[model samples]
Every structure is written in C-alpha cells, then in structure tokens.
Target chain A: MGAEFVQFSLTPVLIGVLSAIACALPGNFLILRRQALIGDAISHVVLPGIVVAFLLTGMISAVPMLLGAAGAALVAVVLIEAVKRLGNIEPGAAMGAIFTSMFAAGVLILEQTDTSSVHLDVEHALMGNLESLVWLRAEGWHSLLDPSMLATLPGELSRIAAVCAFVVVATLMFWRWLKIATFDEGFAQALGIPSTALGLGLVVVAAIAAVAAFDAVGSIIVIAMFICPPAAARLMTNRLGHQVVWSAVFATLSAVLGYVLAGYGPFWFGFEGAVSAAGMIATVSGIILAGACVFGPHRSRVGVAQQEAR
Target chain B: MSRMAQPTIATDHGHSIDPARAPRDTALAIHGLTVSYGEKPAVFSVDAAFKAKGMSAIVGPNGAGKSTLLKAALGVIPRLSGEVYVFGETIRDARARVAYVPQSASVDWDFPTTVMDVVQMGLYRKVGLLGRLSGPVRAQARECLDRVGMADFANRQIGQLSGGQQQRVFLARALAQDADLYLLDEPFAGVDAATERAIIGVLKSLKDEGKAVVAVHHDLATVRDYFDHVFLINVRRIAEGPVETTFTTEHLQATYGGRLAATHLDELAVADGAR
Candidate 1:
C-alpha cells in the first residue's frame, strides 16, 4: 500500500499542492482588489496562448508554452482596456467578451489544426492528466533520498515547485507594496509606489501562476485555487497578513484532501475507477469557501444596520 | 472686491506671476496649466501659486475642474500644458517634501486593512523595500494615528469605521508622511462635525509648524473661518488671494455662475457684507 501510494499518489499530490499555493498567493490580492475575475479571464485565454505556442514552436516545450501564455495574457489585458474605452462598456462585460471570444478562437484553432498527434486537446487542457504522471522508479520513501530515483520523478512536479517558490519570494518581497496598492492606490501613488505599474505587475504575476499551474493540474484547479482559498481566507480574518497565511493553509488542505479523495474514495465506495483529481481539487476548494461563508469569524459586514442608522 | 486691492502679487488673466516672488517660498506653482478630456477642456490655462506656512483653499462649484486642477498640478493626471513646481523645483526632485490626501471615497473602504497599516504606508519611502518596521517607525505611525484620535482603533479594520473615522484615518496617513506641502481634496466633505474639527485642528497645527496646506474646499461658509487664502476657479482661474479679498461675492458668482441661486447668492453676499 505504501509503495503504491508513493508510486501513484505522491507526485500528483505534491504538484497539486504547489499549484494551489502558487495560484492562491496572488489570488488574495486579486480578491481584495475586486479583480478576481482577472484570474478567470487569464485562465480562459491560456488555451489560445498554448495553442498558438504549439503552432509557432512546432513543439510542446514548457518554456515556449509559458511565454506564449504570458504574452497572450498581456494582450488580453490591453485588449480588455481598449474595448472598455472604445466600446464604452463596463469592465466585467469587457472581460467576459474578450475571454470568451479568445477561448472560442482557441477552440476553433484546435479543431482546424492537426493536434491529434500530440497530447494536446480541449479535454486534456481543461482536465489535466495528473494520474498518468506516476513515479515508476520509486521503491517507497527511500527513493526520495536516492538522487537517481529522485531525478526520475515527473518534470511537472519540479516545474510547479520552482514556480511556487518564485511566487512565494515575489509575494514576500513586494508584500508591503501590494498591500498598500490593493487597499488605496492613490495613497500608494502619492507615496511613490508606481501604483499603475504595480497593478499591471500583479496581473502579470497572476497570469504566470495560472499558466504554470494549468500546465500541471489543468484550468479547473487553476481557476478555483485562484479565487476560492483567498476568498475563504478573507472571511476568516480582518487583517491582510492573517488572511494570506490562512489562504495558503486552506489551499494546501484543499489540494491534499482532494487528491486523496479522488484517488482512493472511489475504491472505498466499491467503485472500479478513480475520479478526476483536478475537478475534485476545485470542488474541495469550493466546499471550503462555502464553509467559510457559513461559519468564518469575519464572514459578514460588522455593522450594516447601525451604520445606516448613524 | 477689486482684484487690484490685494497687497501681494495678483493677476487678472491667471498667468505671469511676479518673478520676484517666483522662487524659494512658493509651495506649489502652476503655469498655463490645462487639462482636457476628449474635446472639452476641464481646466484651462490655470496659473496659481500657493505659499508655505499658509492654509489655502481651492473653491469652485460642481464640474468646475477644481479636483482636476489639483490632480494635474500634482502630476497625478496628465496635463495638456503646464509647469508645476514644488518649492521652486520640479515635483520629481521634491517628491519627498510633498504629500497628498485624496477624497475619502477614492479608495475601497471595505479593503482588509487596519488603521495602523494604512498609516504605516506613509512611511514606506523611508522604510524602503524589504526593510523591517523598527520600533521607532511604528512609534511614529502611532503618534500620527493618535493625532487624528484613532490611536485606540489602530488594529481596527477600516470598514468598521464611520465615514468621519475613515477620513480621520486618511488624515493620519498623510500626517505620517510628515511632508512640507500637504494637498487635500474635499477633506471636509461628508465628514461629521467632530471629525471636521479634529481635522481642521490638525491642519492648523501643521500650518503653525511652517508647513503648507492646500485643499479643494466645498463649504464656502467655512472658507473664511478655516483658510487664510482662497483660489476661486470655474474651469479657469476666476480669482485667487487672501480670503478677506479674493473670496468675495463677485468671484463666487463668477465661479458658480447660474448654479448658485439668486436667493443663495444674496445670502452669501449678505454673509460677505456681515464679515
């Protein structure tokens, strides 16, 4: 049982947790800034980005895919602003229109192109093949110490780990700036924070996180992790620092619990096949958010009626 | 009510300040400042100078470009044409010497932040990136918050505060900046009387400390009581000088135009006469 767990579940679970943390770190700021949907927009447009990257590079390498998705996200942000100004539409509407259209273009391109030869498809993009990334050479926990065996682990795990470390460092280095800008942009600007550039940098970071995580656990987990854990953590605490920490905890919890349930719960129910780990992780995050809404300490406004009376 | 009756330098067409008083003591000066949106000009060729150690008010009616003038002068918004100087130098060179307070409604009040956190942001430039908040720095922030009567609410989330308290918190943040020239937009708008008094008291103290205070003021009744100098504008600079001289009925009429009812104008004119 331990060997099977190490071989099949360990790498995917680690990847899932890392991906969740990567997306949720930026998600806290996005949620506070009321730009949570930016994650949804970026994730949706990533399909087209990767498709374009595949076509241009004639390969499915990680670096080219990441660059392509980041470029697409930048284009989407500019296009959304252009549409909002030129078409005189609200931001949400502009975002919805652009992302959906871009996603549709991605689907059309996917259909027109001959991608059957590769592991690229709409289903695979939406729901990653996490289960297939098994550590075949591992012979229990001892394999972790063996460098040769460790090198045999799935590349997705290391990619996500690197991205997760990058996101964590970036978050810590700019923690004060992000907090100030998210709370009061004008005040931040007055203090020489370069608030507009910082705001764009946040979106770019969020896009990078989404693209990296999506490569591992697919878009379902990416979008869910980007919003749910942060939102739940927001309901748990009044302080930004506490909320960010809570979000990381919630994200880690969701990934581990969801992966275990998806992989083993079906057998417990006497079923034959396992469920999709990506979908299950997203569902677990949603459940956590729902629970926070019901019972979190700071779930509701402090004093709406009293305020109105005053 | 004569524009020429003022003792210091004053201009009719708004530009061309006396070159003698042009340097050193001027807190902020705008030359031929114009800002337009699409086709219509919001602020047109405005030229004005605010001096140090004085409390100045920018007064105008709605849509009068009062806010725009402050924003353009501070380089917060792009200006079509203008030169803005802070203490005789470009704002970039004197950035640390200047501080600004936007309207209370400018930021999302429900943001997850405490009063102390917001105040500490004022010290961000000094703290630098990655620097820890030393005890002295935290003490300075606490002192600023205490000035605005928000010391006890340091850990309280901003959304829990009233409109007045929120304004006070913003004032505390500006105070933490410890700036030489403070620019505020509608500091008194929608604030409680206690908060208003507390804010004015702080502004007065800042003035006494030899710092300059510039605000886009809406309440004309308090202009005489609160500010020593007033700049009246309606897209263009109508008049600007001491409150006793520049803030007159004629200038108010020119600034508000038909927006001020005849009866209200009479009341204001009567008030002016009484003063």
Candidate 2:
C-alpha cells in the first residue's frame, strides 16, 4: 500500500495542494478588492494563451505555454478595461464579454489546429490528467529522499511547487502594502505607494498562479481554488490576517480530502472506476464555502458587537 | 480676484507670500491647477493657498470640482497643468508630512479590517515594508483611536460601525499619520451632529497646534462657523480669503451660479445678515 500510494497518489496530491495554495494566497486580496471574478476570467482566457503558444512553438512545453497564458491574461485585462471605458459598460459585463469571446476563439483555434498529434485536448484543458502524472519510478516512501529517484519526478510538480513558493514569499514581502492597498487605495497612493502598479502586479501574479495551476489541475479547479477558499475564509474571520490563514488551511483541506475521496470513495460505493480528482476538488471547495456561509462564526454582517452598539 | 484672501499673496509664480503681520507659513499651495474629464474642465486654472495654524474650507456647488481640485493637487487624479506644494516644497518631496482622508464612500467599508488595523495603516511608512507592527507603533495607533473616541472599538470590524463612527475611524487613521498638512474630502457627509462637532473640534485642535487642515466642505450653513478661511470655486476659482472677507454673497452667488435657488439665496442672505 505504501509503495503503490507513493507511486500513484503522492505527487498528484502534492501538486493539488501546492496549486491550491498558490491561487488562494492571492485570492484573499482579490476577494476583498471585489475582483474575485478576475481569477475566473484569467483561467478562461488561459486556453487561448496555451493554444497560441502551441501553435507558435509547434509544441506543448511548459515555459512557452505559461508565457502565452500570462500574455493572454494581460491582454484580457487591457481589453476588459478598454471595453469598460470606451463602451461605458460596467466591469462585470465587460469581463464577461471579453473572456467569453477569447475563450470561444481559443476553442475555435484548438479545433481547427492539428493538435491531435499532441497530448492536448479540450477535456484535458477543463479536467487535467492528474492521475496520469504519477511517480512511475518511485519504489516506496524512501523515494522522497533519494536524489536519483527524485530527479525523475514529474515536471508539473516542480513547476507548481516553485510557483507556490514564489507566491508565498511575495505575499510575505508585500503583506503590508497589499493590506493597505486592498483596504484603502487612495490612502495607499497618498503615502506614495504605487497603487496602480501594485494592482497590476497583483493581477500578473494571479495570472502566473492560474497558468501554473492550469498546467496541473485544469482551469475548473483553478477557478474554484481562487475564489472558494478565500471567500470561505472571509466568512471565518473579521480580521484579514486570520482570514488568510483560514484560506490556506481550507485550501489544503480541500486538496487533500477531495483527492482522497475521488480516489477511494468509489470502492465504498461498489463502483468500478474513480471519479475525476479535479472535479472532486472543485466540488469540495464549493462545499467548504457553502459550509462557511452557513456556519462560520463571522458569517453574518448583522448581529455583530459593533452593529449591536449602534 | 484682487480680494483673493489676506494670507494668499499672489507671487509671480502664484506661491504664497509670507507677510509679517500674518506670520503664517503656507502649508499647501496650488498654482494654475487645471483638471478635466475629457474636454470639460472640472477645475480650471485655479490658484489657492492654505496656511498652517488655520483650517480652510474648499466650498463649491455640486460638480464644481472641489474634490477634483484636492485630488488633482495631491496627484490622486491626473492634472492638465498644475503644481502643488506642501510646506513650501513639492508635494512629492513632502509626502511624509501629508495625510489624506478620502471621502468615506471611496473605500469598501465591508473590507475585513478592524478599526485598529485601519488606524495602523497610517503608520505604514514608519513600519516600513517587511517590518512587523511593533508594540510602540500599535500603542500610538490606539492613542489615535482614543482621540477619535473609538478606543473601545479597536477590535470592532469596521463595517459594523455606524456612518458617524466610521467617519471617526477614518479620522483616527489620519490622526495616526501625525501629518503636518491634513487633506480631507467631505469629512462631515452622512455624519451625525455630534460627530460633526467632534470632528471640527479635532480640526480646530490641530489648527491650534499649528497644523494645517483643508477640507472639501459641502454644508454651506457651517462654513463660517467651522472654517478659519475659505476658498470658493465653480470650475474656476471665485474668491478665497479669511471667511469674514471671502464668504461674501457676491462670491457665493458666483460660485453657485444659477444652481443656488432663490430660496437658498434668501437663506444665505438671512445667514449673512445674522452674521
């Protein structure tokens, strides 16, 4: 059991956890800034980015694909803003129009292109091949410390782990600025903080996270990880510091619990095959958010001490 | 234009002149400040100065660019052409000496932050990036809350606060800055009478301590009672000086234009007579 688990389940679960953390870290700020939909938009537009990268490079390598996705996200942001200002449309409507159009265009290109020769497909884009990315060379738990065995680990694992570490370090370094800017942008600018640049940086960081996670867990889980964890965490506390911690914990729990259930819950039900891990993970996060909404201590805005004082 | 306030002596560069009699230093000075949304100039070629040891009101009718002027001067909004000085130095050079309290409506009140957290934001510069909030800094933030009468509610989520209490929390944040020049936008809007009195009292105290307080004030009734000086504008600057000299019927009419109804004109006339 131990050797088989290390070979098949460990890397996918680790990737899910790292991806959830990467996306959820920035989601906390995005939710407070009322830009939660940005994650959804970026993930949708990433399809076009990867498609274009594949077309350009005639390959499906990670670096070019990530760059293409980041580029697409940047383009989507600019296009959304332009449509908002020039068309005088509301932000939500603008984002909806742009991301859907870009995603449709991506699907069209993907269908027209000769991508069958490659491992890429629409299903794979929506539901990543998490099960296929197993540690084929691993023998047991001891494979973790064996440098020779570790060298054969899946590329997606290392990429996501590095991105997750990057996101964590960036959050710590810019915690104060992010807090103030998210709370009050005018005051942040007054204090000479480059708030607009910071806002753009946040979107870029979020785009990077989405693209990296998209490579491992698919866009559906990426979107869920971005919003559900942070939103659930928000209901858990009135303090941002506490909210962030709760989000991370919730994200990890969803990744682990969802992975386990998706892999083994079928056997208990007398089923033949396991369900999709990516779908299971997204569903679990949604369940967590719904639970937080219903039962989290700070869920309601009314009946708080400050409101009662009034 | 000739009666443009006693403290604001227009130099060739439109900077304030230090007259010996007033013995007041210019805390904020704006020269030829023009801001526009598209082609319609919101604030056109306006020159104004606010001095330390006093409270000044920027009075104007709706859409008169009173907020625009402040936002433009502070570089919060882009300007067509202007220069702003804080404590006789460029605003960029004197940012540490400046504090801004944007309209309460400008921020998301439901953001997950406590009163103490918002106040501590004022000390962000002092705290520096990558540095944690030290105990002394937190104590100072608490003191600012106490001054605003929100000490007991330090841990209270900001959204749960009433409008007046929220305004006080914003004030506490500004107070924590310990700024030399304070710029506030509609600090009294949606606030109760008690909050109004408490806020004005704080501004007066700041003025007494030789700090400069500038606010975009909408309530015409309280302009005279609440401000030491007034700068009136309607797209273009109308009149500015000590409230006694500048808050005149002629200037008020020009600032309000036809927007000031005859009824309000009568009220102003009555108020002017009472004054």
Candidate 3:
C-alpha cells in the first residue's frame, strides 16, 4: 500500500511542478495588471469550447481543445471590452457580467449535450485526476525516440511540454513591451509602443495558460495556481524580475508538497482515497496565499505598524 | 527682425532682460486652440506663438485652463478645434522632439517603482523593439539625475521620496528624454523653496540651450522674475506677451476681476457691519 502510494505520487508531483511553473510565469503579469480574476473566468468559460471541440472532433485532443478554448476566451475578452467602450460601463462591472454569463452558458451547454461517448463530467472539470494521467500515452514519439524512452514519456507529458514551451516563448518575446504596458499604459503610448496590442496579447497568453492548466488542475484549482503564487511573491518583492522567480519557486514547492499530501492523506484520515490531486494542490496554494496575506510585507499588520512607527 | 529691435524689460532680477536675442524661429504656433471638458470649455479659442527657445510661463487665476492648454498642446487632450504647430509642423510630426512632465499628483506615488526605473522609461522611445539600452542611455539617465540633484537617490523607491524629491525625479526623467520642447504642469505645486529653485535653474539652463519650455505656473510673483514670456488667461487668452507688458494690472483685472471684486466687497461690507 505504501509502495503503491509512492508510485501514484510521482506523476502528480511532476505535473504539479511543471504546471505550477508555467502558471507562475504569466501569473506575475496578471496580478500586476489587476486581471487576476480573469484567470478564473477564462478557466470556467472555456468549457463550452472544450465541449464543442470534443463534439466535432470525436476525440479529446489537447491541441484542438486548447485552440478552441482560446478562441472562446478571446471572444469573452472582446465582449468585456465592448461592454466597457459602447455601454460606458466600468471595467470591473463589465468583466464580472461577461465572465459569469459566459461561464453559465458553458455549464448550460454541457448539460444539453447528449453524447455519452465523451463525458464532460463537472467533478472532473472542477477537480482533475492526476493519478490516471500516469498511464496515458501520446503517439508519434516512438518514431523520434528509443522505445524505452518513448514508453517512459506519459501521455500528459506532451501536453505539459507544449504548454511550457508556449509560455516561455510568449513571455520572452514580449517582455519589454509587456513591462512598459504593465507599468504605465499612457506613458507607453507616448513612447510609440502599441499599448493596446500588448494588452490584448497578454490577455490571450493569460487565457491560453489558464485553459492549459484546466485539465491538469480543475478550473477552480487553476485560479489558485495562477493567482495565489504570484500574489504571495508580489507581497514579498517589488522588482518584476525577482517577483517572477520567487513566484515560480513558491508554486513548484507547493505543487510537490500538495501532491505528496494528496496521495497519503486518505490512509491517515481513513476516508475514500478519491480526493482530487488538483484540488489538494489548489488548497495548498490557497493556504500559502492566506499566510502571505497576514504576514506579507506589503499589507501585513505588523509591517504596517512598523512602518507607522518609523 | 533684428535682435536689437526687441524691447528688453528690467526687473528686480538683474538677468531679467530679454537678452535681446532674436527669436530663432517659430517652434510652436497655437491658432484658435479650444479645449473643452464635456460641454464646458476649459480653454476658449486663443492664438499664440512660442519662440524656438525660451522659458514661457502660463499663469492666471484658478480654473484658467493653464494645465488644460498644456495637455491640448501635448495632444493628450482632444481639442475642440484649431491646431498646434511645432517647428512649423503639426504635433504628430513633432512628438519625437517633445517631452512632457505631468503633475506629480497625477500618479499614485505608492506605485512599486524606483527613481532610476522611472528615469529609464524615458529611453523607451530611443530603444525600439529588441533595442537594448546601450551604455550611453544609462549615462544620459545618470546625467539627468545629477542635473536635478537626484543622482544619489536613483535606486530608492519613488514612494520613499518627499514631494520635492518626487518632483525633481520627474524633471530628471523628462531631462533624460533630451527633447527640444517641454511642457511641464505645475512642477512647483507643492515643492520646497530649494527644490523650486533647482527646477527653475534647470528650466533657465534649458532656455540657455535654446529649448522652448511652457510651464503651467501658479505663483504670480515669480512670473515676472522667472519667465521671459507670460500668458495671462481665464477661460480664454486675456493677453500674452513679454511679462513686463502682459503682467499689467489691467490684464489681471480682466482675468481675475470678478473673484477679486467679490472678495474685496465682502471684506468692506463686513467692516461696515462690524462698525
């Protein structure tokens, strides 16, 4: 039983660590831009896109599902922007309305779908099964690698690799422009930087990252992965570069610990061993965020008192 | 026009003379410039010409649209009508040569950034995509900080600085841009005397380097002392010319007469009632 638990922990730990790192990269910019809630919104709203892709393709391919989900997320952003521009609504109000409405629409679409071959389970969507991911395998790798190595690469490995690669390339390519736009949009415009393009690009990257993490972690868990790590790191540091590095560290640590705890937690508690790994990881991230909220340097009661005295 | 043809005005400050320098060329020309906030006009139609290189002060009563006029010139605010020309070219063509120092109050000081980081933002223009800041950019940023006496505080967070220091840091950032035309909005609004002097000295040096500077100024006493040219305004351009001529009691009456008269009568009436 102990050996079985250790084996089950390995895949969850690896996925959790990689997914946490990927989420942390864009997490810094998302929190700084004050669009942290958009991660939650995108994660929830992408369900309909996932369902539609599955219905048409008749297969659960990561690429098509992600692409479709990205399209839907962009539409949501456009709707929010239109609400702000045409209706003269405040940004928060517009974002709140668009995200909730789209999320409900996605849930409604899921309920109406008649296909049983491809089941879109709410529990699975809200809390992913990291243990089963160990057995899954992606094809075509056998041609490129030795059979032994190919066999070792889990099916979910390809998905995680693709997500990481996308995050790194996008972040590096737009680092300077993103920095300028994040710091001051008006000033960036004055300097001839295309602030609007940079902003929209960030939103797309954010949506992609959120959706990519959705299956590894559930939609709700993706929020904790995307927001809590960054928020904790931001409380500790002011420099953008340092914040990104620290956030990655915090996220990876939490993922490993959370995965280990999820695997053994059932044995100690005498409960059903069916608790979701993604949910546990998210819970760990939430604990970290809450601790940082109380003890973090920026708004901590102790820190504020010290500052006041000084 | 000959350099000697222009009149020079002497004031308490011995260097208050126009220096009788011939206007090099028309750097900026404002014709019928009108700016409004919603339906209410902040700046009425006004025509003016700024010399290629000099310190010009925009001064008047409260709600005189001084900052609004500067914002209009910078193309930040949409103008109701009319046009602004720089070096005989429209604002679009002249943006590369212009720098702006927004009011310190316009931003949240608590924003997470250091003074050097703020100053480095000035190089965003010169450094295009994939354009890294060369050694010269850093050197120039340092030089601007030194010019404003903020060199030592470059690495300090902006929030740690006082109001005066914050204002100086902003000036340093603008200086780093190395633009030919500068529009500053109330640089001395809440600064200390030393900081105010430092800013005025920097502006005077910019003038010496033949850079046109239009500053939204509040202190009427310093208008004649600090500026070579002055524009007295209310909702519209009341008068704009050499400080010696335009800073007259008549223009002051026309620009601030309504409020000043009301206050004077209220004081007199109070005195009579007390008696």
Candidate 4:
C-alpha cells in the first residue's frame, strides 16, 4: 500500500514542480515591479473567462480554455489601468473593485448555467482534483511520438511538461529585457528598450502561467504559487538574477515535498483519503514565505548586526 | 514699489561695474512654449534665450513652473505648444547632449538599487537597448563617481545613503551622461555645506568646459556669488540677464520683496500674540 501511494505521488509531484517553475520565473519580475497582487487578482478574475470558454466550446480542452483565460486576464489588467487613468482612482482600490466584481460575476454565471455534465463546477475551480490528473492523457501525440510510448505516460503529465518547457524557454529568451525593465522603466525607455512591449509580454506570460496552474491547483493555490516562492527568495537576495534562480529552487523544493506530505497526511490525520494536493502545496509555499519573513537572512538578528557593522 | 527707484549699481570693495554688461548667446531658445497639468497651465507662452556656456539660475516662488520649465526643456513634460532648441539644434535632435537632474524628493529613496546602478543608467543613451555595460562605460561611471567623491561607496545601496550622498550620486549620474547641456532642479536643497560646495565646483568646471548649466536655485543670497546669470520668474520671466544687472532691488521687489515682507509681518504678529 505504501509503494502504491509512493507511485501515485509521481504525477502530482511533476505537476507541482512544473507549476512552481512556471510561476517563479514571472513571479520574480512581478514582485519587483510591485505588481505581485495582480497575480492574485488575475487568478480570481480568470474564472469567468474559463467558464465562458467551456460554455462556448462545450469541451474541457486545456489549450482553448487557457488562451481564453489569458485574454480575459489581459482585459482585466487593461480595465484596472483604464480605471486608474480615467477615473483617477487609487490602484489598489481599482484592482480590488474590478477583481471581486468579475469573480462574483463568474460564480453567478456558473450557478445559472444548466450544463452540470460539462464539469464546470465552482468547487473544481477553487480546489482541483489531483486524483483525476493521474488518468488524464494526450490524444494525438500517440501517432507522432510512438503510440506504445504514449501508453506509458499520462496525457495530462505530457501537457504539464509542455507548459513547463514553454515557460522555461519564454523566461530565458526575455530575461535580459525583463531585468532591464524591472529595475528602471525610465532608463529602459531611454535606451529604446520597448519597455511597454516587454511589460505587456510579462503580463501575458504571467497570465499563461496562471491559466496553466488554474485547473491543477485552483485559483487561490495558484496565487500562492505566483507570490510566496518569489517573496521567499526576495528575503534571501537583493539582486534580481539571484532572486530568480533562488525562487525557482524554493518553488521546486516546495512542490516535491508538498506532494509527498499530501500523499501521507490523510493516513496520519485519520481524515478523508482524498487529501488536497493543491492545499498542501500552497500551505508549504506559505510556510516557506512566512519562515523567510521571520528567520531569513535579511530579517535575522545576525543579518541585521552584520549589515550594521558593514 | 519705491525700491525700483534705487540705482542698479551696488558696489563692494570700491568696484563699480554696470550690471547689465554680459555676453549673450542663444543657448536655449524657446518659441511660444506652453505646458499644462490636466487643464491648468503650469507654464505659459514663453519665448526666451539663455546665455551660452555659463551658470544660469532659474528662481521663482513655489508652483511658479520653475521645475516645469526645466522639465519642458528636457522634453520630459508634454508641451501644449511651441518648440525648444538646445544650442543650434532642436531638443529632439540634441537629446544626447542634454542631461537633467530632478529634485531630490521627486523619487522614492527606498527603491532597491545601488548607487553605481543608478549612475550607470545615465549611460543608457550611448549603450543602446540590449547593450551590455562594457569596460569603457564602467570606467566612465567610476570616473563620474570619483569626481563626486562617491567612488568609495559605488556598490552601496542607494537607500542606505545620506540625503547629501544621494544628491551627490544624482550629480554623478548627470556627470556620467557627459552632456553638453545640464539642467538641475533644486540641487542644493537639503544638502550639506560640503555637498553644496562640491556641486558649485562641478558647475564651475562644467561652465569652464563651455557646457550650459541651468539650475533652479532657491537661495537668493548666493545668486550673485554662485550664478553668472539669473532669471527671476513668477509664472513669467520677470527679468533675465547677468547677476550684476538682473539681481537689482527692483527685480527683488518684483520677484519676492512684497511676499517676503508680508510673510515676515505675519510671523512677527504671531510671535507678539504668543508673548
């Protein structure tokens, strides 16, 4: 039974690791840009987008739904900016008003919809089913990458892998521009660095990352993935480059450890056997962030003394 | 109002030279320049040419568009109408030759960045987008820092620095730009005496190198000593010429005397009431 549990944990661990990487890369820039809260806002606001996509397509395909959510998240950002610019409202107030309204609208729409068999449940959007992930598989890849080989790996795992690869490549390609833009927008503009384009590109990437994690981890947990790891890394380093690398490390570690704990936690606690992998992962990430805030190098007494001496 | 009747010639050490006599060149020429904030005009239609390659001070009361004028000159602020020419060319065509130092309080000092990083940003014009900081650019940044006596603290986080040090770092950044025209706003405000001296020295050196240095100055007493030329402004140019000619009692009355007397009287009345 222990071996079965261990074997079953592999897919969740993989998803966790991939999601962590995907979230951490953009998370570093988002934190530096002072737009960390936007991640939380977008995660919640993308709900209506996902539901609308499902309603229109009448399918549970990840690609079309994620693209639709990305479009919606971008619109939400634009709306937030527009409200601030046009209405002269404070940014925090605008973000809070817009996201809550959108999220509530999504819930209302879901309740009114008659498609119960379509798997568009609000509970699924809040806390994902990790058990179902084990059965998820890719369809067309069997003919291209060896039909027999396709039988060995679940299709959802492959899709998650593809998402991770996309994130890694996108981050690498845009790292230089992102670093420049994050540090100083005026200087970036002076150099003709296409600061706005790079900024929008980052928002798009962040949206994509949020959408990728949305189904597997749900909205709240995805927000934790986007925020906690990078914030934890920020306490340890001041340099942007170091922050990115450390955040990726912290995120990957949290994912693997969280999956293992989720698998065993139910048996130990005498609770339902279907433990929430997303909750465990998010909780672990939160603990790490909180730990950094307390005992991390910057906050530690020793660190303060050293800095003072220097 | 009677202060205007006094002679412009005020002698010290028995030397009487006419204040109105100084060379003039079209250092900065503006044609009907206007700038607005929202709906209100901050700077109105102003056509003027500052003298070339000397220390020029722009003095005005608060909200008189002193900083706005500098910003407009730098093309940082959107002008409602008119064009600006630096030297013989348009500001757009001469962007690389101009550098601006904004007010010390304008930026959040707590921003996570090092002094060297901020100074190196001045080289953004020459480095180009995606351009890495090469050895030469690093050397130039180092040189600028050294000139400002900030070479020892190049790697220090800007937030950790003293106000004077931060101001010096900003000056160092302007120095790094190697600009032919420098515009600074309130560079002396809240700075130490040493920092003030260092700033004046840098300005003098820039002038000696035949670069135009225009500063928005607050200290009226030092205007005669520090700046070779002065522009007394109150939403409009009251008078502009060499300090000897323009720093007259009439100009002082026109710019600040009445306002100063009223403020002083109010302060004295409050003191008497307290007693």
lDDT per residue, candidate 1, A48-116, as tens digits? 999999999999888898888888888999999899999889989999999999989999999999999
Expressed as tens digits, the lDDT of each residue in B1-275 for candidate 1 is 56355344333434544434346689998889999976899999999999877999999999889988888877777899978877866666677898889998989888878889989988887887789999999999999999999999998888888899989998998888889999999999899999999999999999999999999999977888899999999999999998877777777889898888867766554256646
Q: Tell me candidate 2's interface RMSD.
A: 1.3
Clashes counted in candidate 3 amount to: 1
Q: Candidate 2 chain A: minimum summed lDDT over ten consecutive residues — where?
A: A301-310
Query: What fraction of the correct interface contacts does each predicted structure contain?
Result: 0.55, 0.79, 0.17, 0.08
List, residue by residue over B73-106, the lDDT tens digit for candidate 4.
7666568897676665555556787777878776
lDDT of 4 by residue, A1-310 (tens): 2434333555667777887788877888887788887888889888999888888888888877887788789889999999988999988888888889888988998999976987778888887666566523433323336666456555566766777788788888766567656765544443345778888788788888888888676886778888999889878765556778888988997887777678777787887675677778888899999999987765453444357559
Off by over 4 Å in 1: A304-310, B1-22, B269-275
Task: Please give the TM-score of chain B in predicted model 3.
Answer: 0.84
lDDT of each: 0.88, 0.89, 0.76, 0.76
Docking class of 3: incorrect
The reply for model 4, stretches above 4 Å from the true place, is A1-8, A135-198, A268-274, A300-310, B1-27, B48-52, B88-92, B249-258, B262-275
Q: Score the docking of each candidate (DockQ).
A: 0.48, 0.68, 0.22, 0.14
In every candidate, how many clashes are there?
A: 0, 1, 1, 2
Candidate 2: tens digits of C-alpha lDDT, residues A1-310: 6999999999999999999999999999988888888999999999999999999999889999999999999999999999999998998899999999999999999999899999898998998888888999999999999999999999999999999999999898899899999988888888888889989889999999999999998999999999999999999988898999999999999999999989988987999889999999999999999999999988888767555876
Clashing pairs in 1: none
- Rank ordering of all candidates by DockQ, starting from the highest: 2, 1, 3, 4
Model 1: interface root-mean-square deviation in Å: 2.3
TM-scores, in order shown? 0.93, 0.94, 0.81, 0.82
lDDT of 3 by residue, B168-260 (tens): 998998898889988888999999999999999999999999899988988766776788888878989988887666666666667787766
Top-DockQ structure, candidate number: 2
